[model samples]
Target: MNVAWYIWLWSDGSALQLQQPIVSTTRCDRPIEAVTAVTGGFEVRAFLFQSDQDNCGGGGVVPISYVAGVRDGWPVRVRPTYGPLATCDPQSLIVPLRPGGVVQLRVDTDDRAPIVEPAQKYDSLLVSELAVSPYLPEEQRGDWVLARAARGKELICGYVRMDQIL
Candidate 1:
């Protein structure tokens, strides 16, 4: 687990495999607490370090509320069937903007304005989304823009790597 996953909150019906309750140099001592039975599984309300040996500096506690837990069926691990974030293509960042597109908009606010640099010219935006132009010879269709929300809807009409899309 990376440092980003420091505060682990599980809302499902499964109990986290945690460090044993006993204090030892090998594992955290009683780091799990506030175990409450929810609709499905248990929701931990508190997690503390009972001993300084666990790196809590003696009674260090990270409250469960401060932690970011799954919101519904929380902690959803979506293995993208397509896009730069695909399970196998970790090296690929050129995702097409089509249906099942999982890449996020990386709009850079240059002086609080949208930077319109060409594709691959800027590092802030995705290569696929920035691959827009009126001169390039046409090819297959580009990726889809699925931005449905309450209000202020927008779409990215641009070029995309056909091979990267579904």
Candidate 2:
């Protein structure tokens, strides 16, 4: 089960083309910064880069969609034999995160933390941590955060404490 993965990305969140598939590889294993499911109803994933030296930019090179399985709504697992052209840019192939954009983020805890309702008055725990977006500052609840978690296939969203995140 040795599969090579490629993350095809577009800044504007454009659709992936089937005719020509372009992709790039990255050794950088960065946690997802934010996520949103508002791209015409489809989930949009994004990663944040603090500096250009981080090599997180896709470097003007566009990526193509593949038929392989998708992970985190971005990275796709393709066959090891599949060969796509390599990028000449200095930066690793990664799409930069935009302001107010969303990407899938992970909880920085070994123990499962409680997922609470953001709109609830009392501590209404839903489930443990699964996936989350960045801390919602607009909510003005400094300790509370908006998060999405799933047991199997069903996805759930709620507010979690900021201390639970990395």
Q: Supply the TM-score for candidate 2.
A: 0.18
The sequence of per-residue lDDT tens digits that candidate 1 reaches over residues 1-166 is 1111222444487556322111112134234445444543334343444332346333334332222222222231111111111111112224433334333321221122121123332122233322343464455334432121111232232223333233
Give per-residue CA lDDT, model 2, range 1-166, as digits (tens): 1113233445477865332122322344243222333322222222333344455443212332222333334222232211112211213222221222222322211123221222222212233222223453435545543444333554333334445433
lDDT of 2 at 140: 55
Q: What is the lDDT of residue 52 in candidate 1?
A: 28
- Considering every candidate listed, which one attains the maximal lDDT? 2
Off by over 4 Å in 2: 1-141
Task: Tell me how many residue pairs clash in candidate 1.
Answer: 5
Candidate 1 local Cα displacement, residue 42, angstroms: 1.3
